[model samples]
Target: FTTEDGAVNAGGSLVLFDTATAQQLYLKPGVFQNATVSAEAGVSDRKLLDEITPLLPKDATAQTGKALADRQAKDIESGLTSLNTMLLAFAGIALFVGVFLIANTFTMLIAQRTRELALMRAIGATRRQVKRSVLLEAGVVGTLASVIGFLLGLGLATGLRSAMGLMGGKIPAGPLIVSPTAVGSAFAVGILITVLAAWLPARRAAKIAPVAAMSSVHATASVKSLVVRNSIGGVITLLGSAGIVGGAASGGTSGRQLIAAGAFFALIGVIILIPLLSRPVIALVRPALKKVFGVSGKLASQNAVRNPRRTGATASALAIGLTLVTGISVLGVTLGQAIDKMTTDNIKADYMVSMASGDSLDESALRALSKADGVTALSPQQAAWFEVDGEYHSASAVTPGDVEQVFSLTVESGSLASLKDGQVAVGSKTAKENGWKTGDTLPVKFDDEKKGELKVGAVYKENEFLSPFVIPKELADEHSASTRPEIREIWIKADGGASKANEQAVVDALGDNPAMSVMDRQDIRDMFGGFINTALNIMYGLLAMALLIAVLGVVNTLAMSVFERQQEIGMLRAIGLDRGRVKRMVRLEAVVISVFGAVIGVGLGVFLGWAIGRTLSADIPGYALVIPWDRLGVFLLLAALVGVLASLWPARSAAKLNMLTAIKTE
Candidate 1:
């Protein structure tokens, strides 16, 4: 036990640690005097020696060392947790995106060989057998991707580990690991997702009647489909969205993730329901557009509207991709805004000073540093998280005179003067998240046996992370002078025009300070900007892969359409329609499809992105989102380009349809 003015006070202590658990106990003499003594018996290997020694008390010294180690380890752990979540989400998105690409490839292959499958059925093969063959083909694709994806995952994880370290995040002591569980999850989920995505298209092949084998072309004119007001798929979709929104509204981490996952499924379900749900609308567009654009335009519009199945199938692929991309982008922005706003309001410091050693600077150095040229003010701040009333609350040291000059904090209730001794100013967001209000008294235990009551000052809406804070520096010094606070960063305020202050110059002049890293305002913005940009790209890239699947779906659908319409094109050539006209028609058909998909994608993507950004901002600091207009324009242009590009080969084939030969094929 250390004495403050000869009054005995046991320092905050860690009482339990094992392979599975670790605990730190902060006690007060009246309520928790024997906490260390009580918990010491729990650890078999590292039992605490209760006896205090003269000169250097064994328990007190060990406890201090343990506390430092624990805090560092926890910081490192928090960093790792973020890294893992980012990667896992990316991996899931990549897998989900790949499903469309692979599914399209299989679908086209099946469509092309429709007559073949029908022939097999005619020759005694069962529908179940045809389904098996199609499923087997999908299985092969899944297996190949899994192997490649796994290899990439390992390499990616390695690079990711190094990148995190370079970006001021902690790196584990060993090489980046791939848990068997993660690998197994990827494999199982990947295969299952692949097979399920292909099932519908595969079923289409299996159900083809034997008459289809004898026909050289799909009898689109003769084939009939059952008309319905609403598809079963569409009903499931609306219900799914309701379930997801309801679950998310219930709150908590699991609920949020479920909401996201539910939305993903919702989009997929919507895609499946598009044919039935959009049929009436498409039929309406056909005649109305026909009169507006005349014969050729009318025909193109009619064809699009006529085959709800094909058009929806093709359009839905792109829609799904666009929705995901847009949603993620929007969410990134909202998250950024929420976090930034919170940080801005909470951090009210004029400048924050760090005192550490070796490169260690402490109270003496801060006193010297605080009086440096171009330094108008400084707050020597010490901060830590402690459990109070079964919840984690931040504890800080603050003084009376230095409060205003340092933290510019606006009290919602109690005055900054009220922070005279044991008062604390809580953040507005913190208060809301933790259900705290003004006039509520909270008791905090620190230094093992020193318990204190901090009267709540008025809540403010600034991120304590961005500015000087609610507490005073002297109180911070006195509290942490004996038990050092973990001081990894410092907040600084410039004396001259902040616009003119040369932060790098000042930092260089100060020399190397081991205890802290100096960062200017621009530095913080740039650092966060860099991370946000990287994060945006990562999210975009994953969704882009998903969109690629849609592109493939486009290529697949158009190829099938081309073959199915070959005779018609040949007949058109025989009539007055030239190669150019036929090709134009095909290309127009593609444009029509792409426009529909792109519009939907833009709408869905924006909504999802905004919602996600809002959620993220509330959770993490420095994540404020601003919508990127330039990117939005780029997204539209890219969709158009990909649409035209997908039609390259098909356009050539459709243009070159041999009149007599094509006519003879049927």
Candidate 2:
């Protein structure tokens, strides 16, 4: 009979029948892959687990319903956690960048309203009243924005679910639930962040003097304030740098956490210090601008440094995005290089054969491959877990005679020839960790209680290509609990190396099993490289959102700058500066700011990458720091391009201004 599809059987057909009838029709007596046991209503799953625990075999495990469900969902949960973390990180970056944009907007708005604020003060408005008014306006804007954002987020989630389903991912069939907590959090965060961003501008507005109602000068931060900010920033930066160095030297999980904390503080410190940094950085680029665009370029450079704080805030957003992207690129490149070095240094086989689905190869498939044309020596590897002194350790079983043909093993203290029955080869790292040495005896037991003792025949140097413990195939076959040993991979040395003909012969021998894959050394390297590239691409995609916000910040800053510099631009136009030159000036200023941010970002990213790589070196064999110079150069070039793109509208607006009207304005 047809059965309703549940979460476990979503996207697939299901049928139900009486267990006795099914056994009579399709099953042999006492034969089944698995059986499900359930308790009556009101019985707890813990009681079921307790009852089954005593009846289970030594190797079997009894889990409660919740435990079993969690175990089964562990991988999916881990994947979702990773995905959510990445999304949240990028989202936070975007929000952080938006903070700068929001702050700048409020600052400019208050600056323009200086006279109005001064008038309010002259009419007996208290500083608190003026501050509260600005904050109230911010709160209203925040509420509206929050409502819009929440609706958009709901739409986006729905779209993502649909897309996942279309891509063949299983999705539970139900309406998406919107929790009260989520709604509350959305409004709370939006309003709080907006009000906080506006606070500084509101304070500045309140500081406007009553006498300033008769003046035309715009409100700006005092020298004392700038000095205080720079001092605080410098102190924070120094602390962050120390933490990074300590984390790198320490090297572990705790060290990584320290590094993360250091990175956050370092980023914030750098952002705070950028206003002080902008002047010198722009000055350094001034000469190049002069050489390229002459007077217009010089004008752009001067204008960029005119408001260092504004320039710094706009550029800081871009810097944050690029820093993350560049750091990830460095790590990805380093990992790819490490894998390439490991494979090249250790693997000697002409070709490697394994299941594409990562399942075990059957004896028949192994036998067929051994008899394939152009095959000279073949080493089949089997993986099994053995309990050694009550600790389960994974061991790889290999043909002792044929291993040397497939792998370039460096014996540190013993000989490979001694790795026979009742003998094992231990990797140096594993040996060091467990205090194992050559000739040390290990009492081991298979899951089926097949007991054996193995002597450490050899202690070899660490090799990333091989398992920590190596055992003879004969010994594994004798002690393994399974009816047959599970062959994980077969390393093949063809008669004429890795040629297409030899690869085809091997494939032909296996009858072209869809589950299996035959790969050369380069193919294996490429497989790992593909994984790294995919991860990098995903990161780049996420970081693009932050970069987009940064671009908008640049656009917003340039637009405001153009508005502020109207009279100056009018004077330049009266002196014969054309629309094209004005546009070029605006674009060049954007480029200078963009390049300045990119330089800091790239430098910080490389340093952070190096620090992270140092932490990984102890665990990863042959790990080395690799800098992808070409990629960094490309990122810098893209930053310049982003500037050019960001300036399009602002430049156009500046060019179209009425010169006479602008010059006549107060």
Candidate 3:
């Protein structure tokens, strides 16, 4: 008994003793503490609860095991839900970018095999047979890739679980289960996406005429097709622009939805019009490229615009990732600014006293805090969930007179001091919603069925610091829940305002409880701001996957472009273009395309951010549109860096091409 030890690591200190010894020391006759119960094997939770419900005393409460577990794991469940949602969204974006890579790869592959396809047609192969051949190849590649990807994903999951455990996360000890549904979904999505991406390219391959086998010309999009595509894109873009403008002008939840829809359409339109946009966008940057890189830069610009479709597809992936990141950044900045302004303008208290664990303070802690020296006034607030006319709402109880000293309440009608026993003060928004005014009576009930009618004595302007319904502390105590109500917060007005001495005095008063904390105005602001920053960091981590996929898309496009232009690069090399200049040309082309996409993405993101902020401003007080220009600039710079890194291998390969072999390639 002198020393204590645990048989297992249960994430906390534990002590074990014989039943009789424990009873003698901690349990007395006719008294009992909480007990844990487990159902017999094969027994359902419902049956267990049903059997145990009648065994408890009339005044005692009983909770099912499932309910208890759910209550304990609520926060963890919420966090996981949010994490899963973000991961799924970004994963979808990655897959969408992959579509462009797969399609582009198939396009180039078919172009390289144009003669082969035409020869098959000349040998009496039907168009359907040729198309099927291409599709069958895609299916085989998809199957192999899917298997490898699934195995890698499984390994990653196991590694992550071990890492989390090493970092002190409480993970259950068991083998990881690979569900059939997940396996099925992985293969289904992979195969479907690959086949779909290759369908268009396969169609193009099938259309190659028999005569094409004797010609060196490759298939290209006709001018008529470009005109049709551009027209469709322009119309969609116009409609999307109109939606965005209307959404910004009309501020509400509906407006937010409209903005979301507008963004979707705008993204689709922009993607379609990128081929047309490539000309002007590259043209604008061509002069700067020439000024800096000289002849190499000029050649790079020409190379980029040579096949606008390829350039457009390569850039689209990066653009999509940047667009999402920029929009989220804008929203996060706006929200952080709004919170800062709201806290500074509304909170009048000199210091806030609360628990470090974020739990409610007991009555003893509140009494001790009230005895702190240099305290001019103290307002202790208690919160509880109460039913009003069958709907559950949160209610706060506080001393009416003490509230005015610690909070800035703009009285729309009546006064806070008039809120006596059997009376309550309601926020303006709540009052308007329920059609309740000063002197109106509201019927409220507690969980124990304790009911009473409270008269509304005051109507105050709504602020973030105050709850909707404020009742007297005496009235709350009379409702018969517990002997003493738990205190949620205590606002203090120090004798000489907020200072180190005042803060130390408050800390000293609560010395018996080491979990209590006293925070000044700045601390409060920082605490809330920290929450927003944490959220933004998580979002950035999730979006990194999409950005990685975009980088891969750039690499794939540049490599394929090098393969298609092998002879062209050889011709340039023969004309006295050195290896360094060849490399510079490729790098400059990537830079132009990357910068082009980043510009469009950033501009679109800013507009979307502004529209969404306008919608939120109607509901949130002090909300304003805040554009993080510095962050946007950094994103553009990173995009340019991505271009340089992506082009390294392709440029090297282009530079290393043999002059004689490349010239005689055709």
Candidate 4:
């Protein structure tokens, strides 16, 4: 019923195509968008819906034909809503931070051209003309940048899809769809952000008095303004601190979210306070600079503090990136340590035999493993998840002998051996939560519609791997209707040490079971630990992209600073400062600002990391805050390198500036 090329073939002999093409090809009725039948006329569509509702899935719904069409449209949109939201959120964050860079650039540019603008205004240019001129210039730049960025993003999207495929993602091959709405939105957002950023600078330039055309004097920030700014920043910092403390005591997902929100608020407060702090920090470094590089260091320090707002704004961008990197590093290291400790302490068995992902073990394999040479004891474990009082919980069925021989069960009240048919052992935390005590009879319901009541025979200490509620193997088999239950793991106690524990014999006995593996305690830990490290490394890689953007901001700030100081640099060269000294001064300024930002970021990150770790430690067993000093040292070194590299172009440009031209610049 469809043209051959127009069809979407999904295997077999069948294909799906447009209805118009189908009708033309077949010349027969096939399927409409929807169809309905009735026994008689005058039956409302509502009646048809009711009659057909019973045949649908429980959660599925039916509607009138018009409503059905609307719902179909909504369903199509609903599929992409989550993906769109994620993209927008990420883009929003980058743009929000990039605003600081954009505003800073415009501020510097406008301030340097103040005299030129005043002259233009004196000659004949109206304030509106001057503002429009600036805005128009910004618009042209924004449009070109947006178009180029959008094209680059398309390539990035294709690269990301291919990268995901290489990483074993299950993405289907399809033609890349570039909708007009998406392109329009990207350009609109970019231009809007650029124009808004330039608005304030444009207004300031237009407001310059014509009399100021002959003046080159710069104004210093007022004390009252500094006081008001610092006061507001302090209040924000205090509020954020309070939120973080509150989050530490709070529990669950909401608490974690509060901690994240608090960190963000605190960072913003610190950035706002940077101008107030910059002068004092630079002053403090003056003595060291004077001692080391002599006059050049003194000059660099003076330039760095000339406009505290400019220096602070430039540093704050780098600070934000470093804070996140440091925070993630601290958290990852702490988590890895906690897991290692937990696994080492809880697992007492000499060896463990288990299947890898997407694999299972049969009864014969279990029996063969149990009968292997040098195996003194074996515990077979199987999972039978069940519901109790409308709450789902993992319910493990373990052989009775394993509790005493293979595991170190710290029974709080009753004996572990008391667990038998139709009896269960609950962890202390679970018992406290559910109000269950030893000797309490609990109603249990399995997925297979089997129901039973089990007596709580014991209450043991918390275990992350083992189920909170444990049942006997025989009871699980009798209640569950399945022909065979897959064995999750078999804990083995060797008569000899783990190395000489006849692992080869156990493997050989399993014969054709290629999926199962025999691993000792350390091997088991490494298998899981490897997954954790891999995930953490991937997160670090993604976070580095933010740092890359921060580096760009640094470069932009330094380049503008070079342009603003051209006359001063020319005079210094005329007096006697060599090109090498000129370059060194620029590079040194970059390093000083970079180090200052990194120090502040690292300090804040450590505090946040420690607090977060403490909060998480309450819920997670064996979790403790651990700081890797070596990693932090490497981080500091990397920051220094980034600073030097970021300043390379600016330093070279400042050194190579035509002294004659710069000295004559207005």
Superposition error at 380 for model 4 (Å):
3.2
lDDT value for candidate 3? Answer: 0.83
lDDT of 1 by residue, 1-666 (tens): 233321122222223434222212122223322233233545532344333224343544434446656887798679789878876776666566556656656666776687888889988999999999888877887788788878887887788777877876653355466788988987888778878878977887787787965585342423234333235566667766765665545545665676677676667767766666455655555665557655555656666655666777677777777777776666655655554465444544433334332133444455555555676555544565444666555555544555456444655655666567556677777777768887777776543335666667657655445232355554444444233444434444566635335454345445655445565544544455466667878777656666777777777777777786777778878887777766666665676676677766777677555444544444565565567677677777777677678877787798887888877755
Per-residue lDDT of candidate 3, residues 130-190 (tens digit): 9999999999989998999899999989998888788786555567988999999999989
lDDT of 4 by residue, 1-666 (tens): 564331223222345667767654433355334445453587788787788889776766667777867887699679889877755755665676677777788888888777778889989999999999988888887899899989999999999988876776645457999999989988998898888878877887787777864475443356886789899989888888777777777856777778888887888889888877888877898889879988878888888778888888877877876776677778888988888877777777777788855344567776887778887777777877778988888877887867557666678988777775557889999999889999998887875677777788889997666888777877776766455675788888777757743766667767735677788888978876777688667656656666776677778888998987889899999999999999989887887777777777787788788768767887778888888798888877888788899999999999999898989865
The list of candidate 4 runs beyond 4 A from truth reads 1-88, 123-129, 167-170, 217-224, 386-393, 404-406, 420-422, 443-452, 495-497, 500-502, 517-519
Candidate 2 lDDT by residue in tens digits, 361-420: 877877897789998888887887788889888888888878878888999998888875
- The alpha-carbon deviation from the true structure for residue 320 of candidate 4, after best TM-score superposition, in angstroms, is 1.1
Task: Give the higher-lDDT candidate: 2 or 4.
Answer: 2
> TM-scores, in order shown?
0.71, 0.91, 0.87, 0.83
Instruction: Give the TM-score (vs. native) of candidate 1.
Output: 0.71
Candidate 1: 10-residue stretch with minimal lDDT: 5-14
Misplaced by over 4 Å in model 2 are 1-34, 37-79, 165-173
- Model 1 per-residue lDDT at 271: 70
Cα-based lDDT for every prediction: 0.62, 0.86, 0.83, 0.78
